[model samples]
Target: MEIVIPEGSGPIAVHGFARPRPERAEELERLLLSFVAPTRAEPGAWQYQVHRDAADPTTLVFYELWRSRDDLRAHLAQPDLARFQRDRMHYLREDLEIHWLTPLTAEAP
Candidate 1:
């Protein structure tokens, strides 16, 4: 699932929440971080970051960049991705919300 986006386009932002389970928070963070290194190494990945809400620890945010939407879709399809999703879903309190983002300006290089 390689997403094809125009060059210099803005990043895609996916934000969502997981269950408010303190016990699984650390494990979730560990699992999420485990994918960080590999995701950054991906060809289309420009940036990939996970953020925890200051007010609510259970709330997680994902900020990702890709050459194109196809790239992001491909990343989601990775083999180990299922495990990641499963882990999060296991403790998630609510459904995930995903959003796609595009740059507002196309500045010249």
Candidate 2:
């Protein structure tokens, strides 16, 4: 599918954190990384990054940007996401909370 971004509009940013059951961390990490390739291949993906915490090994965080909310919706509707949601409960200790971010300013430090 082709994604068209309207002029003067910003990309939609999705940021979230996930913590898995301690013993299931590796299993969950493997599951989470499985989405990267397919998600990055999508037409709407501007960036996709999964971050694993240093001090907290079981906690994983995700930062993703898509062309628009519609693009994000498309991502959510993918088959892998459906399966992931179903399997996540076996590994995750808590629900992941993802928030939409509106970028105001970005600068290099």
Candidate 3:
């Protein structure tokens, strides 16, 4: 999975891959849910969602919306976010794939 944050709207994507272990799947789900509230409360956040692929249980994706590119960059640098990254890293087979995007129009409704 890949997250695509549009350039003008904000970060386009965040993709997470979980360990093959069944338990790791559940752990990633819990961790993602835990971030929802905090991420939604952010000043520049417009949309934030945690997504799991229906076809592939081991893949996770985060769709985020921010006020601007700077806001997205700031979010990435936040200290609180560090812990989540650290914890999730152990479960990922490879580094997360994040994409910053510039949309042609508004994102899909």
Candidate 4:
């Protein structure tokens, strides 16, 4: 799908899902939670949050917004993210499913 950004310098929004191995739900949650503080502290990170489904604890979700796409790219290159990518197979049932969002509503002025 083609994602169009109305403004060239607009914040980038992202939504993603990660399914943990059934037995590793808590472990995965801890690992994911560890990224929150550091990620939120990053230069261009406007928001970085994680959530787990109450009905399906193994399903993890992330909602993030960055100053720009470049910031998001830099975030993906962080050491912790690289390590997570390398080691995710041990804890995840499948790879992360990420969806980049295109804003359709104007920011409140």
TM-score of each: 0.72, 0.81, 0.70, 0.81
Q: How many clashes in each candidate?
A: 6, 0, 11, 0
Q: Candidate 2 lDDT, tens digit per residue, 1-109?
A: 1222333455677787889998889888888899999999987887788998788767899998877667777897799887776677788898786666765552211
Whose TM-score is greatest here? 4
User: Ten residues in a row with the worst lDDT in model 1?
Assistant: 1-10
Better of 1 and 3 by TM-score: 1
Q: Residues 1-109, candidate 1, lDDT per residue (tens digit)?
A: 2223334434554444444356777876777778899999887787778888789767777777666666777887897775666555575555566655674542322
Question: For model 2, what is the C-alpha lDDT against the true structure?
Answer: 0.76
Off by over 4 Å in 3: 1-22, 107-109
lDDT tens per residue, model 4, 1-109: 1223334567778888889888888889999999999999888888888988788767999998887877777887899987887788788888778787755652422
Candidate 3 lDDT tens digits, 45-81: 7778888878875877777766677766677667766
Residue 92 in model 1: shift from native, Å?
Answer: 1.0
Candidate 2's TM-score reads: 0.81
- In order, the Cα lDDT scores of the candidates are 0.65, 0.76, 0.63, 0.79
1 or 2: which has the higher TM-score? 2
